[model samples]
Target: MTAQTAHAAPSTTAIATDTAGHGTRRKVLWGAQILLAAFLLIGSGLPKLVGQADAVETFDLIGWGQWFRYVTGVIEVTGAIGLLIPRLAGLAATGLIGLMAGAILTQILVIDPAWSALPAAFAIVFATIAYDRRTETRQVLRSLKR
Candidate 1:
């Protein structure tokens, strides 16, 4: 390898996957987690927490009473916080996937079926993150036992 070549930036693929396949892979997952967390916290969770009119209206339609709205908001905020923590990302994603599943079902059964697709798409993203970080999740579980 020439000195000039050594100094050159690594190719995208080289930067993307290391010998253990954990280079850009982790970064991509991190980025996705951040984006999703932001959406959940700011776009969805906050409204419910603050009792925004739209959120109140939606929960009213769900017919579960306003308390359920606060419960969902707290769950979402907690999950979003977990997503930002390195060791907790996988578990957070798994939890969020379950939350999304409930959202999907509620949309289909209580609200317009058309809204279910949004949660379905989010569930897929969370699934990807959960699968990718399964090893970290296992480590977290092991640590809890010790």
Candidate 2:
């Protein structure tokens, strides 16, 4: 190797180390995000979808009809499933994140502050996935040419 090459900003070993660290962080974040999604789907989705006792009451109190809850529940379930798949995981996270953001606004504007949990939890999960899989997010953006 030439002297210039030897003095390159990132040596091979340095690049490898950086790559490994990023990979580890990515794996950890993705795992946590997937777990969060599962909780959202099971804890919130099922009850809402089935119109369980408390779930029905809760939705009614929030002025969100049973049909609305059912639709959101289906979306949550689909997003959770998408999170498990590598190819569509980014899209899933994005969709869920958007949904959660809407929920947060609705809670603040239309409902009570107590409903913030749904958005708060979803925000954390969304951030985790976005931060960990930034490369994928970037690629998607690039494809959109935006």
Candidate 3:
């Protein structure tokens, strides 16, 4: 193998790393995204939107006021919807990861530490989705540059 041939492979890697075997992987990601979206929209976001007792109380403990709850609900709902959009899933998952981090911190600091488990679990799932869709995320960013 010539030095030229050895170096040529590295140059093609960027353009060649397409979704050759990501069909099954992507399907799995979609499944997770759907489930998470439903969970967030129904179990979490809606409760905050409607001022469910538990949600209201939790935010109360955080001492951020009920308005913060509304903002959080909006972010959750928006992120959930974005998860279902193929082009936005990566960015959506990335955003959710950040939201979950805040939740985890709140739970540990102001609320029950045990409650942190839920958000931590959610963050892990979002991380996986974000990682899987990174290439798509990059493509989206590239398009936005125009």
Best by lDDT: 1
lDDT of 2 by residue, 94-133 (tens): 8888888978987887778797897878787786686666
| Candidate 1 TM-score to native | 0.84
TM-score of each: 0.84, 0.77, 0.83
User: lDDT of each structure?
Assistant: 0.92, 0.78, 0.92
Stretches of candidate 3 off by over 4 Å are 1-21
Record all residue pairs in model 2 with backbone atoms less than 3 Å apart, i.e. clashing. none
Residue-level lDDT tens digits of model 1 in 34-116: 99899999999999999999999999999999999999999899899889998898999999999999999999999999999
- Candidate 3, residues 34-138, lDDT tens digits: the string is 999999899889999999999998888899999999999999999999999988999999999999999999989988899999999999999999999899899
Ranking by TM-score: 1, 3, 2
Top candidate when judged by TM-score against the true structure? 1
